[model samples]
Target: MKSQSTLLVICSAVMLALSGFSFFHRNKTATVSKKPVRVSSNYRIVIDKSHYELKLYDEEGWVSTYPVVFGTSEMTDKMMEGDRRTPEGHFKIIAKKLHPEWGHFLLLDYPTQTDLEKFNTRKSQGVIPANAKPGGGIGIHATRRNEDRFVDYYYNWTLGCISTKREYAKELYDLLPVGTEVTILH
Candidate 1:
């Protein structure tokens, strides 16, 4: 009888110890603090010429898209100084500058490889200025007083850059960080 009682006591102690071990092992398997998933640099920018729109794409999907204004000569592709077509190419957001006169502007890589070729070829033919630099005068700029402020919100205007309205430009200026990839598609 005494041996049976001792056996019961030992069994109970073993069962309790096993249950405690199981609980601790379960908790060890379910750790609480895990590292967050990293986000890659896969942002994109798209431009629609017909409707004059600039769209930004993110991981989840189309993050934001804004209406834009283009050149005075909106129909044809830009060829020279007076041709009013926004430069269409792969560009990086170079810089963000606040111009008291122009409000806010986003600089683009204008006069790219093709532009350089044309510039050099023109200089060889004595058509372009000798000291002129390529890839200049390309950015999102503000509208002047005489310029159509209303339509500028929806359509294309200015020399050559993605032109957003005053409100949109302000928002974009805050969002458009440096080194953002910009692809201006015609």
Candidate 2:
């Protein structure tokens, strides 16, 4: 009877130790994941659509690169409203918003004069439909607030914006300000 009682106590102690280890391991993982990425330089921002990345650079050198997802029509440049295509060009960060749906948004000054001219030229050449309108309101942002679990794992899933992980967007937002140069490439 004493041996059986000792065995039961040993098993119980082992189970308690394992439970403590699991709790500590889970907390450690959560802390690591919650830590934000560090971004120092913010001179220029470049988005490569084909590679699905956003690279940051300073006058001195390249800073960091973050994986990014784009609009559904990833390969094509945005031409019209509701096209679900991201524009390709040199733009400036015009605004920033903490949207209710979109977690964090850094609005870009898309549809620049160059983009408008391209649209006009294409219209004159009959390459694009005459009624097609150049769209505006493009930006870089994170996933929808409620859909955080599936933000950074996708290929292309935005309407007309660049999408990154929520933590990444927060880091970039803290580093970048309005009027930052942003260049998008095919």
Candidate 3:
């Protein structure tokens, strides 16, 4: 009787684990409400770092949202190079690069005029370290092929770039053109 109970417990545990995994990895979809929707080329992207969501919007309403991963120090705004925190505030999609490692890189115009000014102010107030440097190359991108498992389980694991699935990255890359505005919020 004891051996039979142990086997039953193990089977139940396995079933629960498999169900949880399937629930988390399910396909995500969205639908528009009755509100007027804007089907325009110029769309705005909003990255909510706290929630790990990247939302797309237009003048009328929301377009779609995708799961995203952030840096180690995702709660704080990026201050300098190697901070591992995604920057917050207004930015623009500057360029897109196709690559083997990152899949597709949708570059952003970080360190905008406002960002620079804030950095200077922080420096003046001694908020940032004296040797700190304002880093660049922040963008939205995808993980390498082998790294998919890490991104799937460990959600917050990017250097500073926002990461999503390769398929979602491709969709976003195709939809957003250069000069599209992206707003990253805390």
Best by TM-score: 3
> After best superposition, candidate 1 residue 101: deviation in angstroms?
2.2
- Per-residue lDDT tens digits for candidate 3, residues 98-132, read 96788889999987888888888898899998778
lDDT of candidates 1 onward, in order: 0.63, 0.76, 0.78
Clashing pairs in 2: none
Off by over 4 Å in 2: 1-42, 146-151
Best by lDDT: 3
lDDT: the better of candidates 1 and 3: 3
Better of 1 and 3 by TM-score: 3
Q: What's model 3's lDDT at 124? A: 85
lDDT of 1 at 132: 52
- Give the residue spans of candidate 3 off by over 4 A: 1-39
lDDT of candidate 1 over 15-134, digit per residue (tens): 967854221111112111212322436666777666566777767667666666677535544556655567666777788898766678877767678767766787778775666544
Write the residue-wise lDDT of candidate 2 on 1-186 in tens digits. 999999999998899678542211111111112223345445789998876678887766677787777776348888777788999999999998997877789999989999999889988999778898888878999877654444434446677899888887887888898989999999
Query: What ranking of all candidate models by lDDT puts the best one first?
Result: 3, 2, 1
Candidate 3 worst ten-residue window by lDDT:
26-35
